[model samples]
Target: MELLNQIKENAKKANKKIVLPEGTEERTLKATEILLKEGIAQIILLGNPETVKANAASLGVCIDGATIVDPATDSNRDAYADIMVEIRKKKGLTKEKALDMLNDPLCFGPIMIKAGHADGEVAGAINATGDVLRPAFQFVKTLPGMSVVSGAFLMFLKDKTFGHEGVMVFSDCAVMPETNDKQLAEIAVATAKTAKAIVGMDPKVAMLSFSTKGSAKHDVVDKVANATKIAQEMAPEFKIDGELQLDAAIVEEVAALKAPESPVAGKANVLIFPSLEAGNIGYKLVQRLAGAQAVGPVLQGMAAPINDLSRGCSVSDIVNLVAITATQAAG
Candidate 1:
């Protein structure tokens, strides 16, 4: 499906409030406008209200100050502390700890979502991944069935190279540095489910490695093989395979010659890497060296949508990620 069409679908389903941590950037401000104007959901923008409005006005974007949440305001502090305390009760966080979070406005967004004030959050437009994720782990935590929070990058392309006319997802590139077979399997399942929700299709997942089946040998190769098996067993309704090289995973001719019997040999829409080193370097190669628009490093497996924007992101980067996060939340 087209990117804008996907965004429209997400906007249609969003009914809960969404929070933006750093709402001062041009792209984020514009995204806020898109959300409000589309009537997607109620948006709570973090930062000073005057500063946010000033930034939006300078960017030729008009944002209503009343709709934006200012954590710095005295009126919000007491409520913020109370919300934090309530949400962090499971973590044994004390009143003092909750009060301390009120000092930093960054903590307010995720905390608000955790406290039921908002349904989801979109952050990291101007912050580091660590900063964007800290609050999520502190409050939002993980979904009931998920143990570790993982991430995936959406590769939107219009090239003949992938031999397809659609976008796809590649995962574990930004989250888990190293994963066991179980974790790899879980990543594949989560990524596939995400694909189904956003793309409206059953994802064909390829657990990518340097080897094609048993053509090569290494502990890592075995991990991919085992992960593939686990994923197949866990998600019997989904098509998946592993121990396949990138070429065999995506190239029709190569896949036909390599693993002709595998259902996902050539038509995989999602790729799961066994290690963070491979996932990170591989996606960067595709994005920077191969000319694909890498829309993520988008965080997955969380109960709510909280994405980490690259620190060097541009205004457009912020816009796309906000849209991606909204899609995640809505779906």
Candidate 2:
């Protein structure tokens, strides 16, 4: 709660413009009112103004501060299309096709970010993850020198002694199904940056595996070991150590026995799972069994702070994510 509260405070100070493409969604519209009331951000809702107003009226929510932009009829549509075509010209995109895509609120939102009309975007409620991310990947793309985008979650645990004051960052938990050692290295580096930027933690990252300091032998364990080397080489300043089992990664006693020389072995607050299967299952087990509060699968490594939501997200979920997106934009 303290971490999230700090993030929200940072967001309020950032005063960024966040575009919500699902302007007509009940939860989204409802969240806009809360955001406006708190001054968390300046919001741009993409939809017909009358429909948005009527929907808000029906829902009995006031969205007075939201700038409603109808993507289909906005005067900037032509200019946005021109920017879109220019962005995708190398991919053989045409002006006519770009104009057609701008009709979609999803496409409109990212183009708005790329054109500098908005600071960040949040969507995926009532939409598939692929549909929400496709345009963002095509237009906004990954950050410079980053070939892969990953997801990280801020796991707030019940046991204060376990992590960095009961908080840890879990990565590749929501993206990247299976990655090679190099991609795994990127995930480690990216997750470390996310931990620093969002949680203000000096990330001591542990690359998790079934093995700890060559105690086990397998290709999978070898992959983690190789990735540790790669990630260490990639970011010489960050404390990255790997081929560690989960216990050794976070427990001081276990780390002392298994990886005595590792700088990050005992105090690893950032855990990078070797695969998405392990990451997803691990985070869920901690969230459900250990009763940790999982705050994100916050998408990282994007050029801009675009984010996605589960279709079943609550209004408060929308509000929290917008705050997180704004915080990321501010970072």
Best by TM-score: 2
Show the lowest summed lDDT stretch of 10 residues, model 1.
157-166
lDDT value, residue 34 of candidate 1: 68
In the predicted model 2, the residue pairs found to clash are none
lDDT (C-alpha, whole model) for all candidates? 0.78, 0.92
Model 1, 1-331: lDDT tens digits are 4765666557557655778777676778887776667666567777787898889888888666326777767475677787777777887877877777765656888777766777767677677788878888877788887777888888876674552355778898887888999889999999898777765667989999889989999998998899899889988999889889988998889999999998888888888888888888888888887688887777888888887877777656655665666677766
**lDDT score for candidate 1 against the true structure:** 0.78
| TM-scores for candidates 1 onward, in order | 0.90, 0.97
The residue pairs found clashing in candidate 1 are none
User: lDDT score, residue 170, model 2?
Assistant: 96
lDDT by residue (109-197, candidate 2, tens digit) is: 99999989899999988998889889999999999988898888889999999778999999998778999999999999999998888
Estimate the TM-score for candidate 1.
0.90
Q: Mark the 10 consecutive residues where model 2 has the least summed lDDT.
A: 292-301
